[model samples]
Target: MTAKVLNIIKILQPVVIMVVVQISLAGVNILSKLASIDGMSSSILVAYRLLFAAASTVPLAFYMDRTIKPRPMLTWTVIGQAFLCGLLGGSLLLNMYMQSLVLTSVTFVAAMSNLLPVITFILAICFRLEKVLLTKAPGSMKIVGTILGIGGAMLMTFYKGIEIKLWSTNIQLYAHESTSTNKQDRVLGTLIALGSCLSFATWLIVQAKLSKIYPNPYSTTAMMNVMGSLQAILFALFADHDWQHWKLGWDIRLVTVSVSGMIGSGLMVALMAWCNRTKGPLFVSIFSPVCLVVVTLVGTLILGDKLYLGSVLGSIVIVLGLYAVVWAKSKEKESIQCIEEKEQGIV
Candidate 1:
């Protein structure tokens, strides 16, 4: 019975955990909308998210790592990496995402997230985190998929107003949306959104490397949330100057804070780390498209947003690109196995 249970758990773990991560993230979006109504500053909101996240995870990490002794360097490395992930990726990226959602429509926001895998692949190759072997189908497909993903993002962004002239991609959708946002705000939001993507993409690579070294994703995540929560709170206190209320009492504010922090930030990060460890960052990157799909459907059906053909086409391209990259990975693995087998036979 015990063996059967273990087998079932091992089989279901990835599916169950990925679903949890997706749900937690979706929940965060709802809470962010609610939190905005309370006039919570973005820093304060994210800080609260981190704080409750840390509080929940600390005990779990301690319990899991109680019997396992790790090298100081390893522990510190994971901690430092987690800090970077939280500070730049968690705090800054999230701040941009929240700010961008306010500036652009939800459609644009979701569209931008779909670029994550493409961005990660580019950054990984550029930074030499991932080797790009031109000879291999995997490398070629990764590059092609990256191009398709970026093209899809552009298509969604410009949509019906797409303007084409020689030597430039003159997108007309920007002009239309520019009407929705005044020049100054448009500039600010665009910068913020792009910055968010940069931070997020960089962090994905960082987490991938960190997962390789520190197998304990849970511990790494718990520590980062602890640090991030404190940093965000400090910023909130000075920037917004109203931490006293939530600090003073337990209310819905406190409840949301606790839930978003622990379950959303803490648990999600741990899941990401675990996914990165077991499946590789390549596999985790595919989740970007999954999130985009889920968010889009929800927004359209629930929020009554209009769907566009370009967006539809872009989503299909993204799905296809995801499959291409995954298939390429399998081919590469098979080739590697063949090489190893040949070497063993000769030896």
Candidate 2:
């Protein structure tokens, strides 16, 4: 029974990792909502999250590896690179994500999030980290999937302008209140999201190399958290943020920050690395839309937000596109395995 359970767990790792990612995101939203009530600035909130994650994780990493002296030289540089990636991706976009929640519809934000894979794909191509041979079905599917997903995201964003109905002026009919607000929010939010994609792509590129050099996920995560903690602190200080305005009266503050720090940053990062190893980066990313769907439900029902027709339709298109890409990859992988089996049989 024990052996059978262990085998089952081995098979279930990918599902488990995806669940971790989804729960982590849901936790982030819960925390964001709670933290906002405290009137905490986005930067400060990000700092606190990083601080808590770093504080908690450092000990775990040390305790796990007590037998071996921590190799500073081997992991520090990789950690620093991850830090820079997080600084660009996490620090910039986390603030943007916070700002977006105040201005945009959760559905719109989530739908647009589908663009991360496309953005990452493009960056991967540019960085020469990913290559697709047009003739290869899998590669073609990946490229097509990236395009479809991005196209769907764009449709979701731009479709509002296509209809100038009474609801268009209804302020809450769409995601953001006004065009100017939407534009400003999207301009910053999308940019931040794109930066997030870049950081993520950087992880795909850098971590692949790091894993080749050193395969310790715990150490890698802990050291990167340390650097992220430092960078977040510095950014907060340099931003001239005045903490006097902090009003922690709300009972939800601690709960939210606790969820965000522990689940979002802490557990998710560790699971992400594990998932990437087991499921391939693209495979791990395919399920992100699932989280968006959850967020949309919470946003519309609990938050009392209106869902526009175009936003709904566009989201569907984006999901279809995302699935199409994944399907293509799956088909391609099966074909490769078949040929490998044939070769083994011939031998």
TM-score of each: 0.79, 0.81
lDDT of 1 by residue, 78-130 (tens): 77888887776576677677777666545556666656667766777787867
User: Distance (Å) between predicted and true CA of 77, model 2?
Assistant: 3.4
Worst 10 residues of 1 by lDDT: 171-180
Error in Å for residue 59 of model 1: 2.1
- lDDT of every model, 2 decimals: 0.67, 0.65
Model 1 TM-score is 0.79
Task: For model 1, name the residue pairs that clash.
Answer: 49-261, 53-261, 53-262
For candidate 2, the per-residue lDDT at 281 reads 69
RMSD (Å) per prediction: 7.1, 4.8
Worst 10 residues of 2 by lDDT: 164-173
- The alpha-carbon root-mean-square deviation between model 1 and the true structure, to one decimal in Å, is 7.1
- Candidate 2 residue lDDT tens string, 35-125: 5544567777777777777777678777866676555456576656666645653565566666665456455666766665666667778
